[model samples]
Target: MAKIEDQRIVIDCTCEVQLQQTIIDAVYLALKLEKEICFFGNYLNTSEKEHLQQRTAFYANFVKKDIPSLPVSVLLLEGKLNKLVKELGEKYNTILYCYSGAMDNRLLEAFYRSGFPFYFSKKQVSNSNQFSKILIPVDFRNSSKDSALWGSYLGRFCNAEIKLLVANEKNTEDQDLVASNTESISRLFNQFSFPWSSVLGNSSSWGIHKEAVKNEEPFDLIIFAGSLNVTLVDKITGTFEKRLVNLSEKSVLLINPQRELYLICS
Candidate 1:
């Protein structure tokens, strides 16, 4: 439903205990969509490699217990991560990393530069049912619009409820931008068929994160948008947009501004 089929997902399995389930769940979710799931197995130690394979096999078997025709593959990590990603970039649509707070910022910048729909989660997320609540943070930028459409597609695919959070910034210019962004997003989502809503917020990441966690009903996903074509300079300078990825409590989906979803898939 999300054009997940016929897509390739390269998973970085170089994480430890707490992240193991994240990798397993990622593979399971991908298999459910019949996507080409590829695990980078070369960098892992023997035990880690074995664990990854065993868990992958378990999920694949579970997914295919009755379906019998799931698409999955195990690829060697081969060499450096950036190198592997460069190679995978030609074929894969998304590079998934089950990272905690330990990952280097440089590596993330590399993924952004690689122009893939880089999907990452710092915590475990359940794939047992459709995502019921997806959150999209809106700003007056083209990237935010891309994120809105992408989140809408995911909402439709999962039959989820999608909400837009227009963060009210401090200055008049920023506040006006948020209002304009909200209106534009409302018009855009109106074209889609899904249960959707919107709320104006008084702050960015912190407020949104707090609201998300404080909700008696939690959000299943957070989709962010930014100049995915990030530069070394931007990382050094530290952009607020880049900081949104640090929200590790829930599953976060980031749409690269440099890479648009293939129209064929749409």
Candidate 2:
């Protein structure tokens, strides 16, 4: 775990219609967690790079107007986009990216492979960017812990309630693992005195997201753990990670399973 002050959120600034909403969401989170914001722009040529410098500055000022106390910076990243994103991921704990339907899958995949947690949304920022209810779909994987940790952080900062949607596993081994994972997450929440509740899904792990989206409770945020192993079917259709992001209208916080995530110190 790292001090909360050490956390920084990198916001990918683009010339998309949803850019304003993305900045609003990033600034809201930064204010809530007392973290700094770095507006990042990726460029291909010197001309574009120079233009991005000004663009990032404008966005920075946009955030500053709403959040005067928050610290902000701008970075013009040149060279490969994915490589630069990976490097940025190594430095920042979280990245905020908006899906604009144009090359969104590629942009999201880059973040996914970057091995960092990311907040993705196609719609506008949540009302006042207040996530009072968070949903975390749990399964029999170590990665579930990462998502749970994020859920606890949001729960603490936003004064939100956490709901763990546990997977219904038929296999004996998987059932034991799911139970173990669920208990561990519950203990983590209890340790922080964060309010949490759980419900068993009627479907297996594969169908968990469908169940989550259909949940009666209106969650402001959904924290999902990225799949470590992408199956062949995922290649043809799409990874469950992308599917969840696309399917859910609510904001999603994705935790990459392959990386060791940083936690906010209490």
RMSD of each: 4.6, 2.6
Question: Which digits, one per residue and each the tens of the lDDT, describe model 1 over residues 25-125?
Answer: 56555554446665554453666667767765664465455446656655655445666655565565544443423335555655555655556564445
> What lDDT does each candidate get?
0.59, 0.74
User: How do the residues 1-266 of candidate 2 rate in per-residue lDDT, one tens digit apiece?
Assistant: 33566557777775555776666667777777788888877888988888888888887887778678898888777776666766665565444443333335556567656656777754643466457788989888888888898888788887888899999999999999899999898888998866899999997777887788777248877888877887789878888778767777777888878666655544
**For all candidates, what are the clash counts?**
0, 0
Candidate no. 1 TM-score: 0.72
Query: Where does model 1 exceed 4 Å of error?
Result: 1-5, 23-34, 42-67, 93-102, 122-127, 169-180, 204-217, 226-244, 258-266
With candidate 2 superimposed using the best TM-score fit, by how many Å does residue 16's alpha carbon deviate from the native? 1.9
Candidate 2 residue spans exceeding 4 A from truth = 1-6, 91-103, 122-126
Q: Which candidate wins on lDDT? A: 2
Hey, what RMSD does candidate 2 come out at? 2.6
Q: How many pairs in model 1 have backbone atoms within 3 A of each other, for residues 3 or more apart or on separate chains, i.e. clashes? A: 0
